[model samples]
Target chain A: MARKRGLFETFQERIGAVLPSALQEAQTRVDDRLAKIPTRLNEYGYDAFGLHPESSRRSLATSTLFYRHYFRTETFGIEKVPSGRVLLIANHAGQLPFDGMMLGVSMLLEAEPPRLVRGMGEYFIPQLPFLSWAAERGGNLVGTPENCVALLEADECVMVFPEGARGMNKTWDHRYELQRFGLGFMRLALQTETPIVPIGIVGSEEQQPGLMNLEGLAKRLGLPSLPVTATFPLLGPLGLLPLPVRYRIHFGEPLHFEGSGSEEDDVVQRKVNEVRAAIDGLLQEGREQRAGVFR
Target chain B: MEKVLITGIGSGPGRLLTERLRTRFEVLGVDRTPWEDHPAEVAVHVLDLRKKGFEDLLRTERPSHVVHMGFIRHFKGDPNRRHEINVRGTKQLLDHCHRYEVTNLVVMSSSYVYGAFPENPFYLDEDQPLSASRSYPEIRDLVEVDTMATGFLWRHPEIRTTVLRPVSVLGPNSRSMMAEYLRQERAPTVLGFDPMMQFLHEQDLTDAIAMTLEQDLAGVYNVVGAGQVPLHTAIEETGGVAWPIPEPLFRPGVRMLFGAGMAPWPPGAIDYLKYPVTLAGDALAQAIGFKALFGLEETFRSLRGRG
Candidate 1:
């Protein structure tokens, strides 16, 4: 009974089935390796969460619990993505970051077990010496033009948040709508010829909305903004706190763009428009399905 | 031709619908065969219904109008099995419906959801909450949610669905008050007091199913008998001895019997027996447009006669 399994258990079962034992051995080996390089790693990424958890297998357990507790959402078009190398692009909805984490969890929960699906993240963080070293081990990579090209070519289910820094800023309307997607994804799909999957993350904006902005405070703190939320959660004594609101990540169809051009720019741009149209369809669908995924 | 596939044909309403629907469409019946008995015209297909991949059957049948009827009874063993068949099966069915682009679905559920015993003088209906907290009710309640949600949440809204929950059926071949009367007859002796009872004839259930399927309707409904009776009367009508067993004597023994694993009432069934009470179904009567053909007396008479 599919409904009996529901979305939570079904994702757990399918995704759990996919993690290879070799990855387990590799992860174990990596854990052992990371123990030796722990001190050097913190130089790149801030927030030492006791050094990131070794296993990427936290998709099912963590994803299910996170959604159940935080984001009360409904799902649709989840069965649309056929198993294979796919890319999920969405809007990043927070000044600080949790949008990527939430969507990462959704992808894990949505995909079958041993989901080797990887996320294509910004390169800046990973290139930060040791942090970049940890990012590579922890499945974080830069979304640079060349990096994305390689990631998509490698068949990684890379997730690109086009709005990036711009979309995360506070707005009055609470629109988590995507900013103009750069030509990078369109170019990547043309280059790798892999299907581009667009995901729309709603509810993430409200989970912790930045109703007010402080630019000077941001300059002093070296942060994005002094985005005031309903609650300023204390991270550590001096660290910034975030408002805890629920979140929902919605994924859409894979806009197939494989081999649309025989290395011709005209053909590639036409294919790019088709892919854009597909992404737009998904974005519109995410908006229409607002009743379900959003509050 | 309306492609009609009904699941759980061997159980209650599924079987009732199978008999009632055989005349109208290409009826493909799904049920776990206790033993093979093909009622010509209604092609019966055996399935665990819970296990994955059974959607292949739903696909092959290519039913335009699906009547999802399969579900293990509350008395059935393994609650996981219950959730597996009812909840998962509906999900599978909904998925199949989506894949096939089938337009209509009709599912059968229980009026027992009304949270009451048959003896309760008050009427039981669709509005009453299933009081879903209890174990058995939880299974049935969740099943109802999936059933209802399948209709509500599908991506393709073209498929209209109908969910019917029939009260204790008493029509032809249905073992209504007879089972209770027989139970009260303490082997050779009979119990002194019997509870009040309400029942719906299986034939009336058949008619209601036919009517609902013919018209496209999406909602939950209650099916109950026309009249009610005390179990004492039901016992007499069924030719069983009506011996009054005092509560003081009956209560302790029954409790002890149940406490020991030897007793038959599974924990859920124990709560079932204690049905708090419920109201009559007004919504179902208006929606289906009919009256229950068999009362307690007729139900007993029909049971007295056949298989």
Candidate 2:
């Protein structure tokens, strides 16, 4: 039988034959250098970690690292960010919660972007030395009102998903549905009257297909439901892993609540609804754009 | 059982009510300004919530009840100014409230919110919806709701948030038309027979606050004091005569003089010339455990620099 060889394999074989030190070359090009920033910046909740491009050289050296990777990670309507200490709210998508991570990375890339995001929960920071080093320098942490206000007062941008755990755990059955958002964000916004910048993350769900509901297994595990994708359950290990799908992030304009004082119940409820609606609209827009990408 | 911190405690109803409850409570008094010789004042801290680092102060002195009394009458300036403290700073305080589990809260609102006029009878009760009126008072209404929305905390009750609107606090330092006339030497002037006004003495105002704190109430209330009379009569009772000032001279001065930060707004001023805004709240007063401690006789008598 003739040996079956494809164009991708043939290209790899040719590279291996030409440069016998191929493994070494690949290792040198993808070295992960995560350095810690000054503690003062950390105190203010700033992290430089992997954010700084390898400053020693340009495209050839490691300096343009974050830029090369993230420059391609596109975002739209960032001008919609509300000025001042605002609650940066967005929809939660994907089982791994990469949506939140990329959003934080985008803010760091912002021009004079207020001290990265030094306010979020500690759980999101992966324990890996390289990732943690990057996160520490980047100033990403937990999502609490106290932390949010501290970050805002420090002039650092703070991001929070009002739906908390439930929102991020959204499955295929309810991809864009919002769980009951904790009213804490609303209260803080009203009390601080911080402008709210609604962000929407699409394509994350497609990256990790959530196809089915395994009722018996999920109940024993105590999760909302298993984080499965459309064809994943049949794929086993690959099913649990995320597909490298294209992603899109969109931001809606800032909303300022004119009345910051005691509101009648109806008025308060209405304002909260408006903010939620804006986020929903942005999410739909992002999904639509990502849909066209697939077509 | 819960630690309550009331700021701007040296003046107005804030200090009086705080002092009364201080003996039995762990109350922290904060004010940026001086005490101005208030008779009943507990230990007070000089600090401005409006200034930055408000969150730092809150983290250090975490109290359950944050009765915000520091904000003044006027809400004009940079449109973004009120958000500095009224909204953002208050959020900083609420963040501490949640951190320390200091759930109970009672913030003072203005009866001028009867201005929202949400297509209903303008009785200024809990029933009226406080929509945005693009005015300072209306903004305060929003501030109240936003603070209350922070969380449906469970501590003293199912939820802990209350807003009190005192219809024209009648007292010594008040800038009511009666107050302004007291500062002047000549007779008071009426544009078109200033509308009847309600009065609530400092003590009565203080007492209402004390009652609200003691009861640990949630939601909104209109604390309208009894015994009201026309603005001119109210001024006359304060030992000033009414001289009808012509629209020509009066209009410019009202526009120029009172229009500054030292004065209140239109309905706050000119609205008095109309029929008068009677703030009647039977259910609210009953719910909060308050009795009209000062009547027209007492409120009028007290305005002459007397008890």
Measured against the true two-chain complex, the DockQ scores of the candidates, in the order shown, are 0.01, 0.00
lDDT score at residue B10, model 2, on the 0-100 scale: 68
lDDT of 1 by residue, B1-307 (tens): 6778777777655666676777678787777774256577667767766555467776666788887666665432566666666776777777777788777877766655554332222344455556544544535645464445545534556777766766656544553323542434432211322223455677887887778778776676766666554433455555555444434555556557756645444434433332323335567678767677665566767655533
Query: TM-score for each prediction?
Result: 0.44, 0.43
Instruction: Give the range where candidate 1 chain A is weakest over 10 consecutive residues by summed lDDT.
Output: A42-51
For model 2, report DockQ. 0.00
Q: List, residue by residue over A142-217, the lDDT tens digit for candidate 2.
A: 3445445555654445687777656665666777776666566666677675788887776665556565556668
Model 2 chain B poorest ten-residue lDDT run: B115-124
RMSD of each: 25.3, 27.0
Per-residue error (Å), model 1, residue B53:
4.0
Clashes of 2: 35
For model 1, the DockQ equals 0.01
TM-score for the A chain of candidate 2: 0.64
Q: Model 1, residue B231: displacement in angstroms?
A: 3.2
Task: Candidate 2: list runs displaced more than 4 Å.
Answer: A1-295, B34-42, B50-53, B74-83, B116-122, B131-159, B173-190, B246-249, B258-268, B273-275
The residue ranges of model 1 lying beyond 4 angstroms of the native Cα positions read A1-295, B74-76, B117-121, B135-157, B175-195, B242-262, B267-279
